[model samples]
Target chain A: MVSKNQIKLISGLHQKKQRFANQLFFAEGVKVIQELLQSNFELEHLYTTLNDFQTVHASKRTVINEQELKKISALSTPNSCLAVFKIPAEKEIIHSGLILALDDIRDPGNLGTILRLCDWFGIEQIICSKETVDIYNPKVVQATMGSITRVNVSYVDLKLFLAQTKLPVFGTFMDGENIYQSKLPQDGIIIMGNEANGISEEIEKTVTSRLTIPRFGELQKTESLNVATATAIILSEFKRNS
Target chain B: MVSKNQIKLISGLHQKKQRFANQLFFAEGVKVIQELLQSNFELEHLYTTLNDFQTVHASKRTVINEQELKKISALSTPNSCLAVFKIPAEKEIIHSGLILALDDIRDPGNLGTILRLCDWFGIEQIICSKETVDIYNPKVVQATMGSITRVNVSYVDLKLFLAQTKLPVFGTFMDGENIYQSKLPQDGIIIMGNEANGISEEIEKTVTSRLTIPRFGELQKTESLNVATATAIILSEFKRNS
Candidate 1:
């Protein structure tokens, strides 16, 4: 049986401030819980309907009813399982892999999708600006669909990080050279920008090379590409051309 | 002053059947409404707050109270203006232009993002399998931002469409030719598959050339890429190589 206090505590994690103070986040759905269990991520608690007692160590599992599950779920329709995990605190800067730096990315879903993309591309560490959405946001946690366990996401002052890193910084710009034709270094930070805004002027100055995914239509009426979509194209070209 | 009947009418457009029966869909926020008004789409009604009216078109707009706006709004926080527009019934099929055919895409946001990509790339038509999510879904509409106003989306039997059309049919596959080196046709259908499953087996048979976006990281464990991100990269590459 799950206690009322336990439900309240798990529900509290839906809020960012509460999550940050507690250093924990909630991930719902049976699939997400199952994936997190096998992961190296530490599970503070797991609540499920199936008495998934056989799945984890005694200290980590909690058998709960459907009514109790609903109280802790962020999803509109409550799922059978929900798990809370402690956010990993140690994030090491990898000097030689394909690192991604997000500049003021606001959407939790976009951040989560990017996290999944980073995992798919084998990007080791995701460097984010202070203004970027927290990876632990319930929406983000859900959107990653289990990739949160594998990818390391850390918030850092992007300007300071870019200025100090002794590696090539590639930024996307309309006037920049075409990404298909441009030479890409094997190791560096590929900085993606805000949803509506391109890279900030200060960070733009630090980019060693500015590359663009050339528009197929070349129409002035159409606005620029979405930030996350652009990131996909850039990553594909970088990896494909390399 | 907007009547309760009009408010209810706008709210009803939220559902797919209602949108179809009434021949209308809702567009919210200042940016989306402005783009809709500027596009070829015909507006059925426009409701806005007084603050928004100061800069908006005079005389043709309906000035509504915030409470009334709340009644008609699909958003938790309503924006400055809301518009109900008649979906354009006639869309020119430019056979010579690059086309994007989505087969049973389930995610509204993914479809919306693809539509925006079409707008950015100047892709005039996006053919959808009937099983694909409605373009007017609130989540999809929100994700497209304002690009829905510019892109044409039509639902048809995608397999039949692929078979009937004389142009080349390119589908993404795990073992297909690397997208970077593939010789793409100037004008053809680029068929993207469903979320959980890629292109359907039926659609797969008709694919003239199967292509794959090769992943960069050697140890990547994920079976396939996100459909929307893959769409973005594929579209970019097809345009680049052309």
Candidate 2:
């Protein structure tokens, strides 16, 4: 049974400011919660309709009814379980290998999907601009499907970070060299831009390499690929021959 | 001005049954509405806050306030405009070149993203299982951006359709041959499966070529790519060399 205060706290974690203030974020569903439990993320509490996660200590787990679960769920349709985990302090950027840099990605789902793609291609580090959506957003946690535990994501001043990095910075542009023809390196930062805008100007200036995924469709009226799918193709190209 | 009756009609289009019965669907936002107007889709009516789309006959356009748009819109945050288009009859499936077959894509956003990806890669035909989300779903039309104007999508019995196809059929599987090394054909059907189930067992038998996108992450714990991103990778692979 969850107390009134606990429900308020869990519901408040849906917002970035509240999550930051409490140093905690919650993930719903058995899969994500289980992954968090196995990873370095420290669990604050667990609320569930089912009496699962038997390994969790009695002090940490609360058996709640569906009505109680609905009160704290960020989802429109509440899952059977929701686990709150303390947000670990951002780790030092692992400056090596293929690091993905985001130029103000605003969508939580896109960020989450990109993280899953990074995990699939073995790209370990992600550097997000200060304007990017928070990784702890409930929608992002749901979209990541457990990949949140596998990647290291850090939000920083992207322009400053790009200026100082020794690694080659890559960003896609229409007038840039074709990605299929370009020689991609194992160690570089691939910058994906905002949904409505391509990479911001200051970040574009820091890009050492500019690449383009050539459009194959005949009409050429299709404006652009969604950022997450664009990242998929770019990552696949970079990893295909390696 | 949007009348009470008009608002009810537009709101009802949110459901597939109502859309089909009325033989109409609505798209929100200026870009999507503009694309639909330019395409073969017949404009049933348009409701907008702005006095834009000067080319549209004034008789077909209704200027309404944000509050009125909110009552008729499917989105939580309504866009500036919503346009209802008569659902065009499905076109004949283009038999040649690369085709994307969705087993049972349930999410409207994924279907929209895949359509956009198909447009990017010049995959002209999309065959969807009957269970797949309707292509004319407002969320899909929104997510497609403008690509909905270019791609041809049809719903069919995917199992029977696959069983009779003359072209080589391809589907991704964990144990399938490495896609990067495989000799991908210029003409084939690439089947993307359901969000949760991957490919159904009966449909799996019809796949003549089994391909896999190799995982590069070191942990090997990452399960699978999201359906839309996976579609991007597969479509990119097919077009990169062609």
Candidate 3:
């Protein structure tokens, strides 16, 4: 059974300020909850429909009914289980592995998709700007599709972070080095920008290397690639070459 | 002033059956509507609050006040312009350039994003399985930003289409060859599968080559890349190497 406080806490996670104040976010879906349980992320409270908590991992979890689960779920159809987990503490950047740094990315879905991309490419650390979409948004959580466990997302001053990093910051732009021919560093941050605008002007100024995914057609009418999709392509190339 | 019939017709285009029956689709926003005007795609009607249309490409455009523009808009919040255009007939397969075939892609936004990707990567045509989402869906239209103008999308009996195509048919699978190391053909039909399931079994049989975007993590729990993003990466690599 869910208590009033539990419902309130879970609901509060929907708001960015509330998520920040509590330093926790909610993840639902049976598979997503199970993945969270198996991962290193700290679980605050887990609510499950099964009284017995059937899965081997779910055994340690708390049980609740469908109604309780639905109340806490951002999804119209709540999964069998829901869990609240602490936001993983900021970890020291290893700085050697390929990291993704996002500048002023406002879309939760985009950030979540990027997180999934990072997990796919085995990108260890995503050093995001404070202005980047909060990783813990329920929508972002949904989009990550259970990748939130493996990848460490840290919010930092993006402009400062980009300037301080020793490795070359490769960012995308209209006119830049042809990615096919460019020598990609084995280790560095790839900065993606906001949906409407590329990277912010301040962040763009700090980029050491400007790279472009060469356009295919002869004509110059097609607008820029979707940010998440662009990340996937760029990451695939970088990982493939490395 | 926006006529009642115009409102009904614009609203009706939102559905797949209606779009097909009416032989029209709608596009919104300044960039999207402008792209349709600039590109070779046929525009049946153009309504805009902006005056720049007459100065450049108002081939057969009508000027409307912001209120009328709002009345005709399909967006959540109205934009400055909206246009209803004929769904350009899918051009005959030139059979020379790279092509992408989608199987049962139910999401309109995914379809639109894929079209944008197709346009950006210079993929001239997309062959969709009969069950694939409608290309004219307003959400798909909105999501494409503008690339929908350039990519020729056709729905066909994928089986028949695959049987006819002379180029290699490549499909992505978990057990397939590493896309990076595999010998990718210069021109072929890349068959992207259904959203929930990978490729359909019938179509999978027709795929001459099977390629996999290898996952980085050893654990097999995380969700694979979204179909749209995967398409973007695959198309980019195909074009890049070619």
Q: What share of the true interface contacts does each candidate keep?
A: 0.70, 0.86, 0.72
Candidate 1: CAPRI quality band: medium
TM-score of 1: 0.94
What tens-digit string does per-residue lDDT give for candidate 2 at A80-198?
99999999989999999999999999999999999999999999999999999999999999999999999999999999999999999999999999999999999999999999988
Poorly placed runs, candidate 3 (over 4 Å): A1-6, A48-52, A55-71, A76-80, B42-44, B47-72, B217-223
Best by DockQ: 2
Error of 1 at A184 (Å): 1.3
The 10 consecutive residues of candidate 3 chain B with the worst lDDT sum are: B51-60
For candidate 2, the docking band is: high
lDDT of 2 at B106: 94
Residue range A76-139, candidate 1, lDDT tens digits: 8887788888877767867787789999999988898888787777787899999999888988
Q: Extract clashing residue pairs from model 2.
A: none
Can you write out model 1's per-residue Cα lDDT over B1-242, one digit (the tens) per residue?
88878877887888889888888888888877777777787777788885564544555578888888888888898877787788778576667688999999998889888988888777888999999999887668777878887777888888888888999889989899988888876688899999987888999988998888776565565566678888988888777766
Candidate 3 residue-wise lDDT at A54? 60
Question: What is residue B115's positional error in candidate 1, in angstroms?
Answer: 0.7
**Tens-digit lDDT string for candidate 2 (B1-242):** 78888988888899999999999999999888888887888999988898787788989988889999899999999999999999998899899989899999999999999999898888889999999999989999989997888988989999999988899999999999999999999999999999999999999999999999999967978899999999999988888888
Chain A structural similarity (TM-score) per candidate? Answer: 0.93, 0.99, 0.92
